[model samples]
Target chain A: MKRSLPLAIVFIGGVVFFISYFVPHYISEEILQRQIMVEWIKVISLFAFVIGLYSLIHLHVNKIKRKVDNWQYSILTLSGIGVMFIVGILLPEKFNGGIQQGSIYDWIFMNLQVPLQATMFSLLAFYITSAAFRAFKARSVEATCLLLAAVVVMLGRVPLGETIRSITQGFLDFPKWTQWILDVPNTATKRAIMLGVALGMMATSLKIILGIERSWLGGSE
Target chain B: MKKFFLNIVNLDRRWIFLMVAIVVSVPLFIPSNPPIVPARPVQELYDFIDALPEGSTIMVCFDYSPDSLAELNPMGRAICRHAFSKDINVIGMAFAWPSGSGLGQEVVSSAAKEYDKVQGKDWVYFGYKVGFAQMIIGMGKDIVKTVQADYRGESLKNMELFQEVKNYDDVSIVIVLAAGGTVQTYIYFVNTMYNRPVSAGVTAVMAADYYPYLQTGQLIGLLNGMKGAADYEKLINIKGLGTRGIPSQNWAHIMIIILIVVGNIAYLLEKKQTK
Candidate 1:
C-alpha cells in the first residue's frame, strides 16, 4: 500500500504536469497547482531549516554544559541568532522590515559575510588561472591548437589585441573578439550543456511520471 | 638545491592567495585605464526601455542582497534612472532576502525624488516577501493577493500605479535584478509559465548560464556583471560606480593573465632543460 499509494500519486501528478505544458488551456490550472506546490515547498523548507537549527542549538547547549574547548563560539552564535530574530520580529514595516534590525545584519552582511564570500569566490580566479596555465601546457599538436585558441580568446577579450591590430583597425576590436568568443565558441559549449540539461530534466520528469524515482520523499521505499 | 628551488614551484596556497590579494587590491588604488565597454546587451536593454510607450508598465523584482551591491546595485540605479526619465510606470518589489526590501525602496524613492515622480502614482514598491518561488507564482495568479501592501505596509490595491496591475497579465514587462537563483526562478515562474516577457541584471559568474534562456526568448534582456552595469551607465551617459569599477576588474584580470604567462614560460623552460 505504501508503494502503491506513492505510485498512484506520481501517476496522476506526472500526467497532469506533462499535459499541462503541451496544452495551453490547462496552463492556468497547472499554474494554480504549482502555487500550492510552492507553498508546501516553503513550509517544508522552513521545517528543514528548523531541523538543522535543532542540531546547531543542541551542539552549542551540550558544549556549554560540558565546558568544551572554545565553547564561546556557541554562545556567540546563539546570542546573535536570538538578537537577529528579535530585531527582525520587532522591526516595523515602514522602515522596510530588517532595516530596524539595522546595522547588525548590515554590518555582519557587509563587513563579514560579503568579504568572506568574495574571498572564497576569488579562490576561483586563482584556481582557474592555475588550471588554465597547467592544462594549456600543450605538449602535443591538439593541445597546441587548444593553447592557441585559449590565447586568441584571452587576447581577443582585451584591448591589447586591438593595440596590436591598430594599423588594420579591423582585427583588433576587443568587443568584436569578445562577441565572437561569446557568440560562437561559448554558444557551442552552452548548447552542449543545454542539451545535456534538457535530456536530464526530461528523463527525471519521466521517472517521476512513471513512478520510477521518488527521491524527493527522502529515501522513500 | 633542487628541493629549495622546487619549493618555489610547489609553494603553499597561502603564498598564491597573498599574491592575488595584493594584485587585485593594487589595481583599486592605481587604476589602469580599461577602454570603456559599450556592449550590445546594455544597448539592447536601453533600447528596450527607450522603445517602450509612454506610461508603459515596468515591473521590477529586486532579488538581491547588499552583498552583491558592488555588481548589481549600480545597474539597479541605472534602470531606475532610465525608467523614471522615460516616464515608464515602474512597479518595484523584492522577493529575495528580507534585507533587500530596503534596497529596493531606496532605488524607487531616490529615482522618484530625482525625476519628480509621485509615489503610489508613478511607482509602487510591493515590499520584500520571503516567498521566493511562491511569490512569483502568486504574483502570476494575482499580483494583489501576493502583494497587498507597499514596502511601508500601505495597501497597494488602492494605489493608482497598481490599480491596472492586477496580475502578470497587466504588467507590460518584468525586470528582475538578482544575484543568485532568482533570475532563473523568475523566468521559470513568470516568463515561461505565463508567456510574460522578462529581463534581468545578474552577477557576472551567474550571467553566463542564462544564455539559453535568452536564446529561447524567455529573457528579453540581460545586464551581466559590473561590466554590463558600466555599459548601461555609458549608454545613459551617467558614468558612475560601474565606470570606476571596470579598470580595477580589468587590471585584476591582467595580473592573473601575467601570472599564467609566467607559469607557462617557467614550465616550458623546465621541460626544455629536462629534455
Candidate 2:
C-alpha cells in the first residue's frame, strides 16, 4: 500500500503536467501551472532544503561526537552556518540581523565568501598552465590537430590575436578562423550531444512516470 | 642537445607555475590597451540594447555566484550601465542560487545609484527564488503571482515597475549572465516555451557550447567571457574591469602558446632520439 500510494501520486502528477503542456486552456493554465505546480514545487523544494540542512548538521554532529578523522573541519562548517544564522536570522533588524544589503551577513558574504571562492577558482589558472605544458603533446595526428586548435582558440580569444591581425593587415586572421571553428565544428558537436542528452532525459522521465524507475522512492520495502 | 630537450620536457611544474604567475601579473603593471575589435555576437547584443526605446524594459538574470564575479559581474554592470544610461527600465532577478541574489543586488544597485534611477520607478529586483523551472513558467503566466516581493522583502504590488512590466511579453529581452547551465534552462523554459528573445553572457569555458544556439537564432547575442564584457565596455566607452583585465589575459595566452610550442618541440626531439 505504501509503495502503491507514492507510485500513484507520481503517475498522476506526471500525466497532469504532460497534459498541461498540450492543453493551454483555463484549467491547465490557471490551476495546474499557475497555482498548483508553482506552489507545490516551492513547498517541496523548501522541505527538501530543510532536509538537506538537517542531514548536513546531523552528519557533522555525528562526526564530532565520534571524534572522526578531520572532525575539525566539520566544526568549522557548523560554526560558519551557526554564525550566519545567528547574525542574519536570530537577531533583530536594528542589529543588522536580516540577510539584506548593508548587514553583517552581507559583509561576510562579499568580503569573506566572494574572495575565498574567487581565490579557489583562480588556482585553476596555475594548474591548467602546468597541465597544458606537460600534457599537450603531438604524439599523433589527432593530438597535433587538437593542440593546434587549442592554440588558435586561445590566441584568438585574447588581444594577441587582434595584434597579429593588425600586424599582418588582415592577411592572417586568427580571430576569424577561431570564430569559424566555434561556429561550425564546435556547434555541430554540441548540438549532437545536446540532442542525445535530451533524448536520455525524456526516457528517464518517462520511466519515472511509469513507475519503472523506483530509485527515487529511496529504498524497497 | 638531447639532454637539453629532455630537461626542457621534464622541467618541474612549479617553475612553470612561477612563470605563469609572472606572465599573468607583469602585464597588469604595463597599462596598455591592446586593440579590441568587438565580435559580431557581442556587437549584436549592444545594438539590440541600444535600439530599445527609452521606457522599454529588459530583464537581466544574474545566474551566477561570487566565483564568476570577475567575468560575469562586469557584464551585469555593463548591461545595467548601458540600459540605465539610455533611460531604459532594468529588472534584475536570479533563478539560479541564493547567492545570485546578492550578486544581482550588488550589480543592479550600484549601477542604479550611478544613474540616479529610483528603485520602484526605474528598476525592480525580484531576487532569487527556489524551484527555477516552475518559477520561470509562473512568471511567464503572471509575474506578481510568482514573485511576491523584491529582494529587500518590500511588496512588489506597489512597485511602479510592475504596473508596466508584468510578463515576458512586457520584457524587451532577457539577458542571462551565467557561470553555469542556467543559460540553457532559460533558453529551454523561457525562450523556447514563451518565445521571448534571450541572450547570454557566459564564462569563456562555457561560451563555445552556446554558439550553436546563436546560429539557430535561439540566442539573440552572446557575451563570451571577459572578452565579451570588454567588448561591451568598449561599445559603452567605459573602460571597466573587463578592459583592465585583458592585457593580463593577452600575456597569459601568449605564455601558454609559447609553452605549448616549446613542449611540443622538446617532445618531437625526444621521439626522434628514441627512434
Residue B192 error for model 1, in Å?
3.1
Among incorrect, acceptable, medium and high, the docking class of model 1 is acceptable
Off by over 4 Å in 1: A1-10, A20-71, A91-136, A139-168, A219-221, B1-8, B11-15, B30-33, B96-102
How well does candidate 1 score on lDDT at residue B147? 62
Per-residue lDDT of candidate 2, residues B40-109 (tens digit): 9999999999999999999999998888889999999999999999999999998888888888998999
Residue A101, model 2: Cα distance from true site in angstroms: 1.1
C-alpha RMSD in Å of predicted model 1 compared with the true structure: 4.1
Chain B TM-score, candidates in order: 0.88, 0.98
lDDT, candidate 2, at A50: 91
Docking class of 2: high
C-alpha lDDT of all candidate models, in order: 0.72, 0.91
Q: Whole-model lDDT for model 1 versus the true structure? A: 0.72
Among all windows of 10 consecutive residues in model 2 chain B, the one with the lowest summed lDDT is B1-10
Q: Please provide TM-scores computed only on chain A for all of the candidate models, following their numbering.
A: 0.69, 0.95
